[model samples]
Target chain A: MEQKETCFAKRVRCIVKLGGAAITSKHKLETIDEENLKEVSSHLRQAFVPDSTSANVLGMDWSRRPGQSEAPSFVDDFSDQPAGDSESFIVVHGAGSFGHFQASMSGVHKGGLSRPLVKAGFVATRISVTSLNLEIVRALAREGIPSIGMSPFSCGWSTCQRNMTKADISMVIKAIDYGFIPVLHGDAVLDTLQECTILSGDVIIRHLAAELKPEFVVFLTDVLGVYDRPPAEPGAVLIQEIAVREDGSWSVVKPKLEDTSKPVEFTVAAHDTTGGMVTKITEAAMIAKLGIDVYITKAATEHSVKALSGILKGGIPDDWLGTAIRYMS
Target chain B: MEQKETCFAKRVRCIVKLGGAAITSKHKLETIDEENLKEVSSHLRQAFVPDSTSANVLGMDWSRRPGQSEAPSFVDDFSDQPAGDSESFIVVHGAGSFGHFQASMSGVHKGGLSRPLVKAGFVATRISVTSLNLEIVRALAREGIPSIGMSPFSCGWSTCQRNMTKADISMVIKAIDYGFIPVLHGDAVLDTLQECTILSGDVIIRHLAAELKPEFVVFLTDVLGVYDRPPAEPGAVLIQEIAVREDGSWSVVKPKLEDTSKPVEFTVAAHDTTGGMVTKITEAAMIAKLGIDVYITKAATEHSVKALSGILKGGIPDDWLGTAIRYMS
Candidate 1:
């Protein structure tokens, strides 16, 4: 079969990125909270598979999460191994807490590309990522959701020099054809341009959304919604609808990337990370343009399915921020 | 299809165990002797794909050489963004390496049993295994074998309680199933009686010969045929076979199980691991009653294949010496 240049080949699709803040309790080291995880997990159940009947989900992965000190992961609760405690989730963390923390600590970077220690360090990093992926899969199974754990590196995520040829996209396309969900997430993707690139969850979703033209892209997070400023900022207002350009490009210019002196830390790519409130808004708005009706909301487990149905029913919720990015079109 | 006693079934039809001594250089972890690897890999190529035309292989995994003083695993070879040496296996590893490694290290016994890691330790381990697996796969690929890394972990190789219902016949069944050459090794496995157990290649193979009814089982190891008495002892004759009881059991009057008080570090099975010359001979001769022959020879890449085929075609080389145990009818 001639391969297509896309992440998903056919069935309806949705891209969800676990909020970093929601996953991490502290930096570099921490564990996942069971209560919070359960609440979030139940919410995803309602949101992703709302219809008592549809099997549209190709698959999912918690591409990002808290790490540093050991913490609970998405699939902790579902690991077949009998243990002390575990969590359940529909995501795959790329050894998040460890990815960034270690990257920062080890000073692992692209410049160290082809360097022995750097190479070994990245191996350590990917090991973290794959381990997290398996956990994500366990969680999905506990929820009775049929899913598979796939690494961006092998299944062809955004990394690898061959990605330029869109080989990874085709891999996903074939997966969909087989009625299998191609669960993916932010990962330590190999970069031909940069020695090593950290593909964020947001960028992963963005790439899949833009390429696959899924029914919609939903950002499930611990927070209730996008905020006017950083969620950490006191009294930050929620910006429900993210505005964007006509071609689905994010209209908000990136102020943080001014340096462009190369990515700040371990990963080579961060320019495409969440435009913050701007990034999600822009992705959703553009996806909406594709007639798929994307949703940009917070507290995903709370509204993932309902919001999905709203999008499916062509019912766009009233913009919490009062800025109608898509319907206005 | 009705699931087997275990939903996911693995037949040890054809298993290849690598000699640690072969892959590593004299206990020093600095380099991966490509020459040695090349020779061994070439031998495997002939055995599995003799004509190099059989699509019999379902998948494979090459493994990263063991770590060196905590240096990252071999997996970085597949990192799209390799941090180490100018050329890791990034460009060569097969997908199986990453996938299986992810499953294994993640504490996931198998896809059927694994979800994803939600726990930090397990998650990190999974990722590490993934990276390591990729490197091995890549190394194998570069050698022209084109194998992928398989994580015994992914398919729930360890974390769970093994059902222990193989009837001691799975190994034989797999051989009947074409292109089912699965590489086995000394790895952490799920024990039917215990929570976790590491099964040595020596033990598993012995059990297999009893049930599979193969003409003969061969262990192509790093050293030549076993020596009688100890290596330091002069005039030690190599035992070719051993005598056993009628019921396919070794009735050793006094099978000296060394180190009864050492606590059996990684395994709980009460068996002798060293100087298998006794165990192999005793066990093989016992199976000989079942009309099957067994051979344990030193491994040398150049001659392993011919030696193996020769034994399989005729009988155990007359060169081997041991107490010939037979099943009394």
Candidate 2:
């Protein structure tokens, strides 16, 4: 019991979600966006990993740099003088083109293994997602980050009625305790009520956040941040900050809304079996309610590095374009 | 409860162990014996999977060929016609050269997380073993086998005092229930007593046999079978049959040895963290004690096809050279 407490005391610093669209060519069949993935991996390495070659690796020394503004009290808990220290974190990634097509076509998310197509899709989805996970882990490994690929289904994560009910994360916890980064992705898992269903990465991170209770969370997406509408649409505006109330309702705090009556509209990808942007926001809000700040930013961007490195803790900087979800204090 | 009974009724037909030495060039680091693996996979497909292209693929249509002799009453249960029907089974493979070097170098088998080397080695071993598992899955997939890789460690498998204590095989069961072959491998798992230790594939199969109660088990090794000594040693002879007693003692059946005083001498690989040939025999004996026939034979040989296809059931045929360990009736 004493050993367990000691291990728990070294809480995970952060949980990062690598959005499927950001790392893979979502429209293509099972194709990875190699350049973007490499860039994101490098950014992750610079933010969380401490390298002697790079002096001031982000998160190593949490103190403000020259001419940097003060951080908020919520993040003050991490502003200690620990030089050349690596941050402990877990990564949950989306399946993107790797599995979405098969899962969608076979209706695996609907969950009935009695059909041969669903059963075959279950196998194909796992193979595809796990293969992507291996690629991501390899990229992280090349960047000197010790990453292990962990498939949710293989690890006994399951859902009941399309909602996660069980997940044996002891191995995941042990991996973090041993200084290894466990890389998980969206997967096809067995469901009690449905027989099988797609367990999305968004839901996975939300569950992990509730279990591990990291200091903060970051979602690296393809877009700049959450937009009132699809980013490609004309006059679509990014929502900078979302504050969640005790009642679980949320309001946009940034770009002050003159008309508060209109609820923000978000678009989800047509092929995504799991609710897309809406699910991300919902999950992020849940994490925020736990008193942990959540940041959603474009992958491989300077803003993503800043958000991941604890540089956007106090407030979203004028130059930093992303969405910050926080609890209403 | 009714649904559960229906699923359990479709019990796994057989459990096959692909020896590391048979499928991998063990002397070389992380090298797979591609030719041998392909041949073994092809044989497995032919024997277990019913392909329209190949008639009389082994295991289907259990009726003997023109000149073939009768099978034993024990195997009579499977002698009925099963034309163009696939057999349900599971595959458990060893780490081979893939993870042995990393695990041995860091003493991961001894198990201590305090040392950085051990931690790194644990990650390296997982990476190495999982990569090889992917290769095997891909090979099987190409042959139209719905094989899913399930790492023991990832699935909440753990040991206490070097013995398996917990293994949530719900997913394995679900996969089998859904007609997908769950491919498991020797893995590094957390040990309650040692912090971590290597879980041998042999041990895994034995545990599965106890749980799933397969009709038979096959061990595909590089050598013909369990030899009086190592196969390469001078004047080493193959042991055709051994009958295990209720008390767990066994004696050579076919040889009719005058001297029953000497014990079998088996050697282990220097780099294998899991006990090698000795562990195989011990686990095989335990499985045999459960009243299931256990066959040990060289992979990719006609003898292996015979053993796997249920052709060498009543007794060992002169042409089929291998070891059959059976519970004495």
User: Scored by CA lDDT, what does every candidate get?
Assistant: 0.41, 0.76
Candidate 1 docks at the CAPRI level of: incorrect
lDDT of 1 by residue, A1-329 (tens): 12334443355545555555555443434244445444545455555553422242222232222342222243333445533211111243334353554344333445244443344344444544444454554455344343445555443333443233222355455334433334565555445455455666665655555566655555555466544445565654444444354555432221233334542221212312433454545545656666555554554343555654444345445533222234334
Roughly what TM-score does model 2 have, to 2 decimal places? Answer: 0.83
Q: Best by lDDT, which number? A: 2
Docking class of 2: incorrect
- Residue A106 CA displacement from its true place in model 1, Å: 3.5
Task: List model 1 lDDT by residue over B1-329, tens digit each.
Answer: 11112212333223343444444343322223456555665555555444442332212222122342232333333435422111101111112222233234344343222322423223333343344344444444433343323333322233224432322222123212211222333333334343333333444454445444444454555555444345445654444443355665543221233433433212212222543344445545555666554444554543466544433344334544322233444
The i-RMS of candidate 1 is: 14.1
Clashing pairs in 2: none
Output the number of the DockQ-best candidate.
2
Best by TM-score: 2
